[model samples]
Target chain A: MIIAFTSKGTDWDSKMDPRFGRTDYILFYNEDTQELSHLDNREVADQAHGVGPKTAQKLFERGAQVLITGNGPGGNAAEALKQMELKIFVGAGEMTVREAYEAYQRGQLAQGA
Target chain B: MKLAIASGKGGTGKTTLAVNLALYAAATRRVALLDLDVEEPNSGIFLKGKLKREKQLFRAVPEWKKEACILCGKCSELCRFNAVLKLGKHILVMPELCHSCYACSELCPENALPMTQKSLGFLRHYEQDGLDFVESKMEIGVEMATPLIEQTLAYAEAEIAGADLQIRDCPPGTSCSVINATRDADFALLVTEPTPFGLHDLSLAVETMRHLDKPIAVAVNRVGIGNDDVFRYCEAEGIPVWASFPHDRRVAELYSRGETLYDKVDSIRTGMDAIHTQISSLGGGK
Candidate 1:
C-alpha cells in the first residue's frame, strides 16, 4: 500500500503541509517496496477555481491508499477521495512528514470526518 | 445601443447611475435597464412596485450514467474545471464547479456522460415608469457568475428588442463577471468617487474596458466627500467625465429608503440628463 503525506518538502523530515488541495509536495511512502517519492502540486495551488477537486484527482491517480496530513481534503475534494476509498488521517499540520507517519503507525492520528 | 454602467470600486454608485440614466432616457425613448450584478443584485430594490415576470435559471452540466459504463475516463480528462472524475468503476460529477461548456459531454467516447440542467439562479423583469427593469440573482452557493450572466443577457436581448437603449449595470471590479456584463456594450459609463482608492480601482476598470475595446466615460459620485484625484486621472487619460453627483445627505437618505434622486434633486436630474444625451448620440452613431 502507498501512503501519501501532504508536505512542504520532498523528504520525510520536511514539515507536513496542512492544506490538501494546495500542498507544495505530496510525499509518498511505499510499504512493500519501502521506496519514497513525491508529486509537486505548487501549480495546482495557484489555480483560479476547483483546486481541491483537482488535487483529489492527483491523489487518486497516484494509487494512494492512505492520506496523512494536517487537515484533510475539503468538501469537493473529500467527495472525490471518499469515492476512491482512500483512508485519510488528520492532526499533523505542524509536524514533519516522518512524525506524521510515525503517528499514523501508532494509531495516534484520527480519521478525517 | 447597449450602454454599460460599471465601476472598479464597490459602492461607487454604478447602480445609482444605471437606474437614473435608464429612467431619464425612458421618458422619451424605449429603454431597458438590466442589472447584471447577479451575485448581489440590489439594483432592483429601487424599481417600482411590481414583479411583472420571474423565471428560474439553470445551466447545463454533465451527468454520469453508470449503466452505460465504459470506464474510459475520457470525461474526467476533458473537463478543465475538474467537475468530473472517474474513481475506480464509479464516476463523480460536481455541478458547482462546472462552467456549462458542454465539452466533456460532447467528447465522451461511449456517450456515458450526458448533459443535464442544474439550477443556477433566477431572473425577474418589471415595468417601472416606462422603463423595463431586468435583474438576476445567482444561487447562494454557486461559485461561477459568467454562466448566469450570459443567460440573463440572452433574456434581456429578447425583452429589449426594438428598444431605443439597453443600459446594463455591471458588477464591481474588472473580473470575468464584469466582462460578461459589459462585453456586449457599445459605450460604457464607469462610475467612481473622488478618493485615491477610487482612482486606483478606476484605472483597473479602464484597463479592462480598453481590453474589451468599448468606448468609455466616467461619472464622479459624492464629489465633495473626497479629493479631485479621480477627476485628474480621467482627464489625464482623456476619458470624458460625464456626470458629477454631489455629496448630499438627502441622496443618502433617499437611497437608503429605496428611492431614486432623479425627480426630487436638481443636480442629480441634470447629471442623469447629461448621461442620457451622450448615450442617445451613440444610438444615432450605429
Candidate 2:
C-alpha cells in the first residue's frame, strides 16, 4: 500500500503539511518497496477553487491507497477520495513526514472519511 | 447610454442611487433599471411593478457518457477546472468545479463528454409606468457571478432596447462580478461613504475602473457621517464628485419602509437631478 503524506518539502524530514487540497507537496511511501516519492503540488495549491477535489483526484491517480495529513479533505474532495476507496488519517499537520509515518504505523492518528 | 451604479463597499447606497435615478429619469424618457447584483437582488424590493416577463437561465456543463468513453482519461487531463475525474473506468464529473470552458467536452477523443444545460439563475422583468425594472436572482450556492451578469445584460439589451437610458445596479466591490457588470457601461457612478474604510476600498475600486478604462465619478452617500478622506482621495485622483446626499433621519425612515426616495425627499430629488444632468451631458438625453 502506498501511504501518502501531505508535506511542506521534498523529503521525509520535511514538515507535514496540515492542509490536504492545498498542500505544498505529496510524499508517497510505498510499504512493499520501502521507497519514497514526492510530487510538487504548488500549481494545485494556488487554484481559486476545487483544490480539494483536484488534490484528491491526483492522489487517486498516483495510486495513493492512504492519506495522512493535519486536516482532512473538504466535502467535495472527500467525496472524490471515497470513490477511489482511499483511506484517510488526520492530525499530523505539525509533525515531520517520518514522525507521521511512525504515528500511522503505531495507529495513533485519527481515521478520517 | 448605460450607467452602472456600483460601489466598492456594501451598504454605501448603490441601490438607493439606482432606484432614485431610474425613477427620476422615468418622468420624461423611457428608463431601464436592471439589478445585476444577482447574488442578493434587493433592488426589486423597492421598485414594485407589474411582472412583465420571467425567464430561467442555464449554463452549459459537460456530462460524461460511460459506454462512449474509451477510458482514455483525456477529458480529465484536459480539464483545467478539475471538474472531470477518471475513477476506475468511470469519468465522474463534479458540477461545482466546472467553469463550462468546453475544453473537455470539445476535445474528448471518444466524444464521450457532451455539453448539457445546468440551472444558472432566473431573471424577472417588471414594467412600472415608463420605467422597466429587470432583476436577476442567481441560483443558491453559485459562486461565479460573472456569467449570470453577462446573460442578464444580454437579456436587457434585447428586451428594453428602445429605452432612452439604462441604470444598472451593480454588485458591490471590485471583484470579477463587478467587472462583468460595469465593463460595458458608458459610465460608472461609484458610490462611497466618507469613512476611512470606505476611502481605502473606494481607492481600490477607482483603480479597478481606471484599469478597465471606464469613466468613473463618485457619489458620497450618508453625508456628514464619515470623514473627508474620501473626498480628498477623489480630488487627488481627479475623479469628479458628482452628487452628495445628506445623512437625514427621514431618508433612513423611507428606506426602512422599502419606499423609493425621489418623491419622498427633496434633497434626494436634487441629487437625482444632478446625476441626470451629468448623464445627459454624455448624450444620454433623447
Candidate 3:
C-alpha cells in the first residue's frame, strides 16, 4: 500500500494549494499496491496553518495501515480515519516516518487503543 | 461601525490597540469586542472580563458506507483534497483532513459518502465593564481555524449587529483567518511598531487590506523605539496615521500586567477619543 504524510488537518488533497507556512503535505506511496495516504501532527490544531482533513484521506489511499502521531483518535480527524478502518496511534513522538511504518508492519498499533 | 485591528507579525501590539480602542469606544457607545486570535488570544487577558457563555465550533467530514462498497476507487479519485482513500475492501475518511467542500460526496457515483460533524473549537462570550467580548479557542489537535474563526465572527455578527460599534482583535499574519476577521469590517487599524519586522509585515498587511478593498489607517505603537521606516512607508502610500504612542516604560509595564493602554496613559484616552470621532465621521455616524 502507498501512504502519504500531509501537514494538513483532514481534507482531500485536491483542495489544498502550496503556500508558505501552509505546505505540510507528505505522501507515503506503497509501490506494490500504488496506494497513498498521509498524516498531520496535532500541532496543526493551533492555527490550521497547513494542516487539513485531506492528510488522513491521502494516507488511507496510499494504504497506510497505521497512523502514529501526537494526536489521538477522538477528535474530528479520528472519526474520518475510523470510517477508513485505519489504526490511529496517538503520542507517537519524534519517530521518523520509517520508524512509524515499521511499528505498523509489526501490527503493534490501533485507533487510540 | 466595526473596526479590525490587525498586524502581520505577532507581538506588535495588535491586542494593545484593540483593547484600548474597545475600552475607549465602550465609554461612549455600546461596543463589542471580538478576538479572532484563536492561537493565543490576549485580548481577554487585557480586558479581564467574566465569562458569560461558551459554545463549541465544529466542521463536517464525509463518512463512507463499507457494506455495499465495490472499492472502485471512484470516490478517492474524485476528491480534490485527497481525503478519500480506497484500499482493498476498505474506504476511509479523515475528518480533520476534510475541508467539507463536499466534492467527494457530490462526485461519488456509488452514493457511499456521508458527512458527519466534528468539533473544532470553543467560542466563549463574556461581559465586563459594559463591554461584550467574544473569543474563540481552537481545540488542541484540530487544524483548520478558518471554520472556527468564521463561526465565531458569525456569532459576533448576530449578537452585535445592532450595536453602535464593534472592535475585532484580528490574528497575526495575512492568513485566511485574518481575512475572515477583517473581510466585513468598515475599516482596519493596522498596528505596528517602528522596527524592520514591523515594517515588512506591515507592508504585507497593507497589501492584504488593499486586496480586500478595505479602508485602512495605521497606528504606530512604540513610536520612538525604532527608526522612521513605518512613517516613510505610510507617507509614500498616503495611508493616514491615526495615532502614535511613545515607548513609555510605564505603558509597557501596564501592558505586562494585563492592563489596557488607556488605563495606564491618560493621554491615550484623548487619543482614542479622537480616533473614535474620526472613524465616526468617516462612517457617517454621529
Compared with the true structure, model 1 gives a TM-score of 0.91
What does candidate 1's lDDT look like per residue over B99-206, in tens digits?
Answer: 888888888877888898888889998887678888999999888899889989999878768676888989999999999999988888999999988999999999
Off by over 4 Å in 1: A42-47, A70-72, A87-95, A103-113, B283-286
Identify the superior model by TM-score, candidate 1 or candidate 2: 2
lDDT of 1 by residue, A28-89 (tens): 89999999999899987556677787788888888999999887888988877777868899
What are the per-model DockQ values? 0.65, 0.65, 0.18
For each of the candidates, the C-alpha root-mean-square deviation to the true structure, in angstroms, is 2.4, 1.6, 8.4
Quote each prediction's TM-score.
0.91, 0.96, 0.73
Clash totals for all candidate models: 0, 0, 59
Question: Per-residue lDDT tens digits of candidate 2, residues B1-286?
Answer: 9899998999899998999899899998999999999999998889779999999988988898888988988888877788888877678898888888999988998888899999888999999989999999989877677788999999989989889899999999999899999998989999999998889888889989999999999999988987898888888889999999899999999999999999989999999999899999888653
Clashing pairs in 1: none
lDDT of 2 by residue, A23-113 (tens): 9999999999999999989998457877888888778888989999998889889878878877889999999999999999999999997
Which docking category, incorrect, acceptable, medium or high, applies to candidate 3?
incorrect
Top lDDT: which candidate number?
A: 2
Weakest 10 consecutive residues, lDDT, candidate 1 chain B? B277-286
Q: Which ranges of candidate 2 are over 4 A from the true structure?
A: none
